[model samples]
Target: GLRNYVQMFTEDPRYWRSVVTTLTYVVIAVPLQLALALVVALALKGMKRGKAFYRSAFYAPSLLGASMSIALVWRAIFNDGGTVDHLSGTGGWVNKPGWALLAVALLTVWQFGAPMVIFLAGLQQIPAELYEAAACDGASKWRQFLSVTVPMLSPVIFFNLVLQTIQAFQVFTPAFAVSAGKGGPADSTLVYTMYLYDRGFVASHMGYASAMAWVLLVVIGAVTAVLFRTSRSWVFYASEGDR
Candidate 1:
């Protein structure tokens, strides 16, 4: 059955368009989210006052982000007559394709807590002496950060990149909840996994969906492999070869 459907879905331009849509979202959302998280992590490192409070505050949204209640809240915020539209005053921004994609991106960006926390922990483990040593050598903050901070944190960054990329590729709940399962306003928000759901469950094209699932697995695996191979030149493991 999958054999039959694979041939059909592959030949269908509409199905490929759905695949491209999902890939585009993952490519944009994942990197931007991680970059923002890294910046937040850098800011929080070594702060003395209100550290616990701030960390918790930043992390709270992520913890609750995927919950049904939170998804409903997001839906309300982006609805036609919602606060975002009222603020923009454009009357129908949410219904527009560009704004709708942006709204989804914002939803993904809001869940930065996990990666931020990971980066914070990684930043903490980096020795303060490294910074001090760089300072004594007359290295500017930017230079020291480039030469030392980045190298030391490369392993952590690599880990987060891989994990988050996979998560972004598999994203479903936010799109489903925010778009109300219709993918919204002209299928602009339809992600690959959501498409898979439509095919497998809604359309009862189980075989086709299964093939798409495997294709997704292969695509993710290939991307991950590329990251790992590229990392050999960048990621500096402290325990190199001890494993």
Candidate 2:
């Protein structure tokens, strides 16, 4: 019964590689996406005109989301001798072992609209008077962002962090399509879900696949729990302060 689980860590070197690859993808993709989204959200928060248009335009990519079509388009852009190579005069990124995972991660980072919108909403909830007070106190914009914006937005940041982290762990289509359903050129892009799919469907090892699913769930839960635990140190809650 537990043989499949045991084999995943003990017998299967590939699974270990896949786990590392998945973590690398999540660590790279999620932070970049959140950073981009937060920057956009901050810029949009200051804009006085055509904000809706810009928001819609920025958000269009998230609407495209993780579809096969989007993934295929991404693959073409990064694939060897594809559009990116034509423009940059370099070999495509999708084939290189070190660069392939980053290439796939870029696709997800490009769709930063969802978190950007959430950040914008959170920005809207923050009081402008707080900024005015910060300005009056001779706080630099950077200082204001650190003292006022981030502390106030910590809840929203934490929320988006959890959301993006969980989503990143489950990413499938981008790697699948970018590598043509093969996490190659050397399994550098072999994500957890992609490998799980191989075990479940491609190889018909249903029991092993199910075990992998359980492992994923447990990992997600454990990571989420750790986030919640550590968040107490930095995550702010005005309600708690009020009480």
Candidate 3:
């Protein structure tokens, strides 16, 4: 049992590559998704008409995000000479090592509705008087966003970041479906969870996969703990003064 654990790290260079690929995916996908979500939430917050319809339309993709059918659809779009190719003229995305992971990341980004709703709720909870005060003090819109909106929304942002980061770490289906379960082209989309699945189920390295599973749990816990630890510096509570 323990031998597999030690050998997984010591014996396989792919373990390190998977770690790098996983982190890259998380870094690219989570921030972009949250940024897009926040932007959409802000736009929705200011809208006076057709809010429900627009929200539903945007969120519908998230409902189908994890489905195999959507993944297949995404594959079709990003494959050689597909819709995206016709628009961007960038050719296919999933067949090139440099672009395959980005295609997978984009699939995750397209499902930003859940976080957008959460951000919208947070935005709604913020007192309008705060923005009024900022404006009264001659703050520009950008300054007001930084000083008022971000501070007020920090908690919600942190919440989304944690959830998204955790979700990104477990990403497998999109990569699997897009790459046809092979983690190609050239293993660019071989995220940690996919590699774990490959080792355990495909290669029959159950012991190694089990070891990797425990490590992943530990790494996630440690990352969460680190985020909490560092959050004290940036995450502010409205009741902080009471402490």
Query: Whole-model lDDT, candidate 3?
Result: 0.92
lDDT of 1 by residue, 171-222 (tens): 8888787788877767777888888999999999887888889989998999
Tens digits of lDDT, candidate 3, 1-243:
577568658878888889999999999999999999999999999999999998998899899999989999999999998998999998889999999999999999999999999999999999999999999999999999999899889999999999998999999999999999988998899999999999999999888888889989999999999988888888867867411
Q: Model 3 clash tally?
A: 0
TM-scores of the models, in the order given: 0.92, 0.97, 0.96
Name the better of 2 and 3 by lDDT: 2
Residue-level lDDT for 65 in candidate 2? 61
Question: Going through the candidates in order, what is the number of backbone clashes in each?
Answer: 0, 0, 0
Model 2, 220-241: lDDT tens per residue? 9999999999999999888797
- The candidate scoring highest on lDDT is 2
At residue 124, candidate 3 shows an lDDT of 98
Model 2 segments more than 4 A misplaced: none
lDDT order of candidates, top first: 2, 3, 1
| Candidate number that wins on TM-score, 1 or 2 | 2
lDDT of all predictions, in order shown? 0.84, 0.93, 0.92
